[model samples]
Target: MLAAGRGYMEERETGKQEAVASVREIFGLSGPLYLTAVDWENSHHRRSVAASLVQGVYILERDRQQKRQGHQSHASPWWNFFHFQLISPLIDDVDFSIFGAIYEYNSSVFEHNAPKYVIAFRGTLNKPDSRLRDLKLDIQAIRSKLHQSSRFQLAMQAVQDLVAVVGTANIWLAGHSLGSAIALLSGKNMTKLNYPIETYLFNPPFFSLPIECISNPKVKHGIRIARSVVKAGIAVAVKGQHHSSQKDDSFFVLSDWVPYLFVNPADHICSEYIGYFEHRKKMKEVGATKIERLATQNSIGNMIFGVCVRDCEPLHLLPSAYLTINMSQTPDFKRAHGIHQWWDPSFDGQSELHLFR
Candidate 1:
């Protein structure tokens, strides 16, 4: 009888341990290293401030994954760690899943220098359930049809509603990868309406050839100038077709709303932005400002497509941005494109910033 009682107690203890392990795995805490908390007060502009925003977007992914696994937790560990309360989740009508969230700041804990509300969007998740819709949106983004997508329309409406209520002074927009593209488009539209809100974009795709990979500087510069001349020619050819007044107004107006763009040089998906901004500066130095300005506003592919289909603009082109490049050597593309790296402590002093205007 004594031996049987001892065996039963041991089995119960083992079951409890297994249950704990299962929960940890569901919450993405199975690994040895976990996410660290940020110091909200001391978070410098580009360092900790950027990390917090990126982390907020990451938590949206976590929240969805946890619920998908039947954990059904009311609170997210990551959001709680950052002292943010989830106001409401942005759900996909078709999938009936959460893609983004609006978080309200804990004013008691963080008094000043913080956003009153942050709307964060998560990138594509490769899971079986969400893969189809997410990939469809990504393809639409590449084709410049993202604006017509249901998800983007939902996001735009959310931003507009929030701005209407809060007046856009303390509201912020943040996202990662595909989410970043959505945020970028939303910010651009808001700026066009003269409602400029703070935006943080992580690993935003540039949708161009990875020109930064070319080893020879002279070769790269020559190629860029050639492309610019060709694009400028196309712009002039179609100048009569396009509405000059609207195009010029939007181009100059967007310059006032600069979004914070964080990218990794090792990640090809977004590294083209580095070359785009650098080449513009070089053009100015070489006294090719006229050609560069025309090229920047229009793209040959977009122009031809717009003529055939409808009026459309290149999704990746930006009039201005505060671009930050992670110079740290990452092990792989997955890590380089990940949202976690934005919050890594090693990111400090390992980044370069350029104000592209």
Candidate 2:
């Protein structure tokens, strides 16, 4: 009995260690703005601030690696076709640490292709302060405060500046976890404003519509009307602009750029039931869906009491090409969720890179 007890304790310790390591890797990749002291009060203008933050000491290694990847002979064909440049910076506020990266590509080899940009967002940190910070963000997320979130706002500013300089329909976006949520919301909002860009959502959270949207019909209706108005305005403003040729897929042709969604079926945050029907269909197109309805049902029940109260169906979130990573041997919960698991270097070989961009 004593031996068994010792073994159990050891197992628990190992699990805790793994959890810590997983979270640490995410913060490390996000760089040191949240890890170190940040001068929030006297921060420079958004453009200069973003540029300076990308030069942070901690992020240098990743920048170096990205550059090295660009020079690799066996790099993706996509890389060979265009010249890629990157800028990453952590934008910190009182509530959240938002990590943003921009990749600029110029089709030097191909004329009339025009320059393009890819914006990436890093998920939440696992630090002590981040835990406290998440308390407020959790509430805000439940409220679906996309426009109100400082992190979301900062991301928009970066995109807006880039759009002005490089122009539209040439931008792509990517993010994981909380960052994914922000990216989806931002992409949706931007599309309504006629600045449609392709996006990649990596393990997006389950609560796409927010609990508040479910509870308050008026708020939901108001948001819908507002978006419709924005879309109408955009259509009028860009009426004479040249439209790009649609991609091959019927589902992808709905938007300007095809959004690619990378997820693990076992991921608690992004299982089969989490997103809309169109999203599930896209996931099916890429790979098999993992059924963990009991876990998902329980998770949803816990997150929003509003779901229980409301009889009507909640609104669907962004639609994209869903790519699921298969891990039959590992526990569904263990293999799924968490920012680091999906993109960590340790699992690079395991990642399904061929299917989606």
Candidate 3:
């Protein structure tokens, strides 16, 4: 994995590439780690933010090692080849750094192309006033991560910025909680704008869309494309059970993604409070198709393309120190239920992604 992420950039770009490579090392997380980085704020200048649907991935066993894995591939060629073919281009697409992947054990290596632009976003729910902070975020000490940028915002920014740097561009949206929702939404926005988009939704929340796009073309377009995820059954989504008020937290599904992942129960409201200050009143959301309906639909696309990606419990959520969940029972998987957007092997290997960038 280090070799794949290290020195990935050109002669002059090595510094940035290495920085991304060392993310896990700097953070000191245990087990496999997945992270995203992006540059936003500039995207709206020529393009809207683009979420990196995918990012670097890793797996940890026993010793709980957080790094070092290139040696494992020596045992298998397919895994080696998978590593070379898939991972070599992670800067541009998915990287084969993790185990159990077709590319994880690839053999051949290709000449590198242009250096991939990195991005970062701020997904932590940080607010000045204690009253303004989301309880979930505060509990996670996300408020303390002042230096950490929002992966969701950064990924969208990266999508928009990469266009200026990369001749061709694609949006890869992946993340946990808010980051995941932002990535999915950002991809939808790109779809509407008619940009070259290949979205990678990871643990994306079946969140309620903001009311700002009620009449916007981008909003409408994103909704339509998002519906496609539903049709494909790739999205473990949730719809607002109560339509009366613009702000409702009721869920419509109990099965599918959220429950399967077994993320902290309080993850459900992480958005409600996180999006605070911006939409304190609990804004209205618009979706082409209800999240609940997508749950029941048995489409060939979902069954065939969609992989049941989650384990009964996420490796990160197993301990309370890392994540303390406040569970609330509800039918709506998206609302007040950390059920819809989740990571795991059930939906394929997207479980480890942190789309905040």
Candidate whose TM-score is highest: 1
Q: How many residue pairs clash in each candidate?
A: 0, 0, 62
Error (Å) of candidate 3 at residue 216 is 38
For model 3, residues 90-205, the per-residue Cα lDDT tens digits are: 11122211211112112244313212332222122221221122233223222222112242234455566555555334222333343334443444435434453433322223
How many pairs of residues collide in model 2? 0
- As a whole number from 0 to 100, the lDDT of residue 343 in candidate 2 is 31
Q: Which of candidates 1 and 2 is the stronger one according to TM-score? A: 1
What RMSD does each model have against the real structure? 9.0, 15.8, 19.1
Query: Per-model C-alpha lDDT, please?
Result: 0.69, 0.42, 0.27
TM-score of each: 0.83, 0.49, 0.28
- lDDT (0-100) at residue 2 of candidate 1? 6
Model 2, which residues run further than 4 Å from truth?
1-85, 88-90, 95-98, 105-115, 208-258, 272-275, 278-316, 319-329, 332-334, 339-357
Report the Cα lDDT for candidate 3: 0.27
In terms of lDDT, the best-performing candidate is: 1
Q: Kindly report the root-mean-square deviation of model 1 from the true structure over all alpha carbons.
A: 9.0
Instruction: Output the worst ten-in-a-row residue range by lDDT, candidate 2.
Output: 1-10
Ranked by lDDT, top first: 1, 2, 3
